[model samples]
Target: MTIAARMDRLPVTRRHRVATVAIGLGLFFDLYEIFLAGVLGSVLEKHFHLGKSELALLLASAFLGMFVGAVAFGRIADRLGRRRAFLLSLGTYSLFSLLAAFSTGPVMLVVMRFLAGLGIGAEPPVSDTYLGDLLPPKHRGRYTAWAYTLAFLGVPAAGFLGRWLVPEAPLGFDGWRWMFVLGALGSLIVFALRTRLPESPRWLAAVGREREAEEIVARFERDAGELPEPVENPVVPAESGRLRELFVPPYRRRTAMMAVFHVLQTMGYYGFGTLAPIVLVAKGFPVVQSLLFTALTYLGYPIGSAVSLPLVERVERKFLVLGSAVLMAVFGIAFGLASASWLIVACGFLYTTASNLFSNAFHIYQAEIFPTALRGTATSGTYALSRLASGVLPFVLLPLLNSAGAGVLFTVVAAAMVLVVVDVGLFGPRTTGRVLEAVNSRVGATTDQEAR
Candidate 1:
């Protein structure tokens, strides 16, 4: 039996659940910093006397850090290992986040934020990659989807924490500073616990460590009271991962589709998510009311993720993504048009829920598309565009919102979703219930058959 099959045959158990929670926490903090930035914005502006442009620059700083980190660390992860890269990323972000609270001015704050972003940037793609490696093909979609489910909770966690902490100095330190400090402390604990996460046996096999890979899979099987199917021992072949392969033949189509997916996904995903409160305020809700509404609306993130938990395995990931994107377009307009507070929160909740479902689908899809050899590199390289688009979004989106109104803002978001629907609907392939190696092997078969 193939190592991938061995992994796929194993049952879901307590170990997988524990590891999911650990990885989920890592993803959570990555988002906590992201949503926390919005809460930090008004406070920083008042303190630093930042103009609209400067605040955008500050916001973009972390995203730019993410862009660089994702691409650079992606290659590093592909070369080294997922576990090391995960810890490195978590530590870097945590340490720098703690330092961000100490910044004396805007310049210092931006630099620290940018540094922290390097770690932030590496984590989601890496966590997505790592989780993909650990989970079985049968259970892959929902297991990884559950991680994002937990991760999106970070959005509301930030909202509630920001609401509680951003009003004034805690312990005579800025409330915004306290937010960073708390994120940093929480990350440090997760970093230490991550040592317990088992290395990806799939990655081990791909890198020519089949014995280690088999042993781990065997351990999982033993725990399930079932030994794995027997296979003759042979020295594993090494994977010489080629960057050019991604742009060639079968992979190129997937590469292109994911590129378009990530870029288009980010415009609405982060733009609305991080900017929710601001968007509500722009629509004429009072500041306090906007914060209250944002907190209420954030409840939908976990709700959406939990909804997808069971259905993820039941449905096709491609269609799920398309379905969620369509709902996001519909709900964004509803949110913009609603006048009463309850309607506004209702529409916003729907939008958040759909957007998170969109997030879970693509996050799983992108990682599933490539071989373990190139999974980190391919996913992160494409995912970087989302990071870059997210970084640049505030620059374009904020201006559009300020100049036009929420109507124009959401119209543009809805327009972007149109592209998302077409791209995934036409080009995206189904990946449910297939081993990663087998999935890529079929691609190889296609190319060879075409060549013949």
Candidate 2:
């Protein structure tokens, strides 16, 4: 199907909100587990007596697994089904997280982390694609933001769990092991809840499973009233799924741009998140005190999301992306340079607020830019690149942190954030409040003409 044609079928109804809540809960746990890894890093270091490089390597291993999981399961989600793929990824991570709790050495831990990354990496794209497809263009940004808000809940929850659990190391295991075990158990519970949720109607229709799609849509309507009218139908027949769609014509440049943006953004965000506690420790705070500060910094995430919920509709998404990127660059540097713990904590809070805004907008922007036919693949493909970059930065930055200190490390991240602001702001087309079909039509036409 042509991009324009594929977009005309987005489901619009109150059910979108219901579906969003259900899927958003799944995302919450997914993110919770991913962020928990940073805290777990400190515990693992002490437990295994890992040097800086070894810790970095373990992080890199996980990202490598995430990269593979994202790209591979993304295609699977698109080809197989979003609902099935969602459960698969969730189950994969939950199982591996339990395995991680039992790891006896660095090698075993790395292996389990890699496996878990596969599941973690596949989630956002699938969830974003599903949520985007469910909501109408008019409400897409707000609904998308709502979905992300749930995911960001995991950030603080991770900190809370770390602060509370990391010190205990209950039942002959360290706190880090308990973190993994808790995550595993939580995921299993989420997986059971997900089984009760229905599949995406739009996805089923796109893949020519019209009967199944109608049944799902009927279920949604039964619960939530009527769906909105489709904006347009470009009238192209569906064909076999193609991986090359993302690289062809107009999509190629946007896809490439998004990939670079993802890489740089992750470098900045994860660079700060993963290293902030260590920076606090180096500045003279005790371990427990540093973890508390880390938790305080995360408190800004939900605040950022709550604030963005109402304002996202009023602003251009590209501008919001640019504005947040600049804030991240500026405050991230300030955070690294502050001598006073209070100042550092305040700056870290602002940094996370801006980071949350950037991520929330970026997730909505990227998923909307793609056609329904390839949304999962494109979003996941870009996310995989981002995860890979994030996975490697800690390893690289750890050495720099040891040699150059926090100022130099954050300075580099600040520079990367600046580049991302330029790339996304200058080149990205505005997507605020536009109909999905209209956006895809423009992108498709531009891509086709460029191909010629």
Candidate 3:
């Protein structure tokens, strides 16, 4: 059996669960940091006496760092190894975030945020790819979705932490500083735990380190049962894929699909993410009420992810994505048009739920679609576009929301959602339950073929 077969054939085990949780926790910090800015903004605004422009610059800083990190570390992960990339990124975050706590001015904070954002940007693609490489095909879709579900917990965790800490300066330290310290400390813990995980055997073999791959597989087989006898096939050498191949046949389509998908997806995510609370305030919800309700609304993120967990394996991944996209357009429009408080809240919940489901589907899908030799690069490259789009959306989406009203703003979001439906519904292939090599082979015959 090939490495893909052995990987797919292995049963879920404690070791696999540990790896997922550790990696997922690393991603958890990333999301926490993402939402942290929103929650911490008021306090930060006061401490620095920041103007609107400076605050905007501060919020946008991390995404800029993320863009650089995603592109740079992604290529590094592909060139070096997933494990190394993972450690390097988490380490970068831990060190810089702790440094950020000592920041004296807005300029320093923004720089630190951007630097920390690099790790934040680099982690998800690597985590998703690493999980895909580790989990067998049978368990891959649902399990990875669960990992992301756990990651989404960071949203609520940040909100809750902000609520508790922001009002109180603990031990004479400001709440914001404590938040940074907590985030930094959490990342370091995950980095330490990640040391236990084995490198992706698929990546190991792809890199011409078959001995290392086989050693890891031996440990897996002890719990997963022995893999079927090996079958011979031509090896695809490490570093075989060229960067220019991104614009070629199989990859070109995926690149285009992912790039467009991310543009809309990021706009939708950050648009709603940033705008929803503001919309409430505009609609006359009090500050405390909006904060409370916003927290309530965000409950949908993790819950929605969990709701889709069972469906990951049962549903066709693309169809699930298409279905969620359809709902996002419909409900987002409804949310914008909602005048009643309950109606707006209900629609907000539904929209968030659908968004989480959509995020999970694409996270699993993007990692699944590409060949291992190019997976990190392809996934992260498009992911960087989303980061860029997200960073820019606040500028465009807020203005549209303020001037044109929610209806016009969501109409634009709905239109973007249409791109997702069109791309994945028409062009995307089935990935659930299929072997990674087989899926890659179907696309470009770029991967080593699956055993007969």
**Highest TM-score, which number?**
1
Off by over 4 Å in 2: 1-14, 224-230, 233-240, 442-452
* TM-score per candidate, chains pooled: 0.94, 0.92, 0.93
Of the two candidates 1 and 3, the one with more favorable TM-score, higher being better, is: 1
- Measured with C-alpha atoms, the lDDT of residue 278 in candidate 3 is 64
Per-residue alpha-carbon lDDT of model 3 for 12-108, expressed as tens digits? 9888999989988998898888777766665686789987667677777888888889998888878899999999999998898999999999999
- Candidate 3 Cα outliers beyond 4 Å, as residue runs: 226-239, 442-452
User: Candidate 3 — worst ten consecutive residues by lDDT sum?
Assistant: 443-452
Regions more than 4 Å wrong, model 1: 227-239, 443-452
* Error in Å for residue 337 of model 2: 0.4
TM-score of 2: 0.92
Q: Please tell me which model should have the higher TM-score, number 1 or number 2.
A: 1
Error of 1 at 404 (Å): 0.5
Global CA lDDT of candidate 3, please?
Answer: 0.81
lDDT of 2 by residue, 260-339 (tens): 89889887777777778778877788877888899899888877887789877899888899999999999999998898
The lDDT for every candidate, in the order shown, is 0.84, 0.80, 0.81
